[model samples]
Target: MGWAEKRTGIAFAIALFAALAAPDAYAANGAYAVDAADISEVGSCKVESWMSVATNTDFSAVANPSCVVNPFTPIELSLNTNRARSDGEWSTTLSPKAKTNFVPTGIGRWGFSAYAGGSFDAATGENLSAFAVIPATYRLSETMRINLNGGWLWDRTVDRHYLTYGIGFDWKFTDTLQWTIEAFGQAGASDTPSVVQPRFQTGVRYRPNEIFSVDVIYGRNITGENANWITLGTTIRFPVEGAQPEHRRTGHL
Candidate 1:
């Protein structure tokens, strides 16, 4: 197996172990221990699956396929209930690792993770893949932390991999609010064999309560298409007890 495939296999094993052992390790229902310093007394996990059908599907005679051009209209909607799972966010760093404050020191806290999902395109069927991230956090002082994040995408169907890495800083201005600044590059290769572009993002997050939080993120690809996008998301996490809920999406440390 190639490096990407091997890494993915390892990540899958880790996820399976976590899912099976989560019940015993995290018995309480609504709280998570993020780090040694920050622990949530009540936490939960959330998994969100989204699907949208475009209104206008343009069929091309040359390509013999219908594709959605820019400004795709959306149709159909479904929202899940509530879930309590691990968050997927991480601090930035050179080392491709992930760890919450709760993870033990000796164990491999910072390493790899895997996910199984489907593609948005109708032609593509169900797909399962793995990804690796390197997250590092540096404490500037009592109220400031800097994070560096690098991400890699390993597609199982196409047998291709993409890479993006960036560095950012976070300032905990208050107990409940913080701001973030980040710049990342598309280090991964595309099938067309074109050079990847660099991207920049800025965002802020707010914690109204211990169990719930929200963030607004804006990003722009500077190299080629210069695509600019903004995202507003909220998260709720907690511990697991018995048979967990199927969906209700979903981050990290």
Candidate 2:
């Protein structure tokens, strides 16, 4: 099998093993928000997948599958793909992301993380430009935390760049339930109108067990096209042998 196929198989196997093992774990990433500083325990693996559909039929449906490998205490690597279908035409984009945690969770009152990644068209196999972001989180209380992301995306296809940012708050209502709300947007590069409109999203997450969690979210664009979308997703984590026990703390999802 090809390398991509092999990787997919391995990820699937790990996910299946995690599902069957049934350990207490937590997932902080949201349906529509990226986790700035959240990482699984060292030597563990996580699988996150979701499907989103637009309220209008003209917009394509998107399916995303992401796998994360945490080999050390402060660094994690991720591989993910976006599969989209519109009017019977399908396209796929693959991306690899790396995150470094400057302050590991529960180690201090505040945490920081930096991430960088790029996406490529599966059909053309051309290298897309890279992007970077710094995400910071502050612990307000045991049950509340706030996160912010600021970054830039350089578009090779159009030879343009854009500023991207997100602000969000996470609230834990119970050990197994949480809610998140965020506003995110992109601004045009160099005074041009932003290609990506801004949007507001809210979601709820429920963890029925330690290793599994579910999310439901809805969002709408604040400017241009008036588009609305909803997403459903689940996350699963597998603890490798010798990995540390789960760390429960408030941080970005």
Candidate 3:
């Protein structure tokens, strides 16, 4: 090819990769244990779904669809449904969650966010759990970051109050390939202790474009049970057709 044609191709490639790295909702798309301190742009929405296979008693599937809106504050709202099947028995849970970033996430800086949510039994509407979490992030560079979390959880089933924590690291090898590893756990009022102990997870996220991602993860002791799990998850992100609200922050680590 001539020099001009070659130069044009290189320019296009650079532009495409830059768009993929743009600060958007996909930055926090595929985390299993620690949530990111970022949110989708206002008027943007996404749907995340995953299935995990482990022992018969620990197999589960989940669907969570969420959207960001700027009513008074820029917040992301989601409704998640989970179905667990084990030994021909099935149980369902419904959870609603809300999150908003307090400090914007950027390269070589720190960010913070807040999350609140509750879950109930789908069959009986019985309260199962409620939680409030503070998530923080520090971007070591444009392609690497660290996430930290601390929270409080109310285990309605056992009437126990627990403290939760998480630490995670992200490394982006390229515009389309990324890896993350995290450790998370909970501890209750020591006397009774938390039902679920510490857990570890690692995942690789693949983004073919700016609006889609696929993740495969391996988790250890996922649910306080000594079960190893393998999960496949995906996320689809897009902008709302007519709703337009000013975005609070733009760009990500």
Range of the 10 consecutive residues with the lowest summed lDDT in candidate 1: 59-68
Model 3: per-residue Cα lDDT at residue 62: 75
Candidate 2 has a TM-score of 0.76
lDDT of 2 by residue, 1-253 (tens): 2322222222221121111010011012534553434444444567677676665542322333344443433345655565665444566666666665555433246566666677677799976656777666676766777777777777676677767677778887887898988876667754333236666778898886667888888767522235676777887767556533343322323
The residue-level lDDT of candidate 2 at 60 comes to: 29
Residue range 1-253, candidate 1, lDDT tens digits? 2322222122111111111111111100111101111111112233211111111221110000011111221111111111211122211111011222222111122322221211222233233234444444455554554544455545554666666455555566776786777665445556533225654556677766545556665545322234444445455434334422211111122
Q: Arrange candidates by lDDT, descending.
A: 3, 2, 1
Among these predictions, the greatest TM-score belongs to: 3
Model 3 TM-score (2 dp): 0.81
Q: What's the CA RMSD for each of the models?
A: 15.9, 9.2, 10.2
Worst 10 residues of 3 by lDDT: 11-20
Best by lDDT: 3
Model 1 residue 234 CA deviation (Å) reads 1.0
Error of 2 at 56 (Å): 2.5
Question: For model 1, what is the alpha-carbon lDDT of residue 189?
Answer: 54
Judged by lDDT against the true structure, how good is candidate 2? 0.54
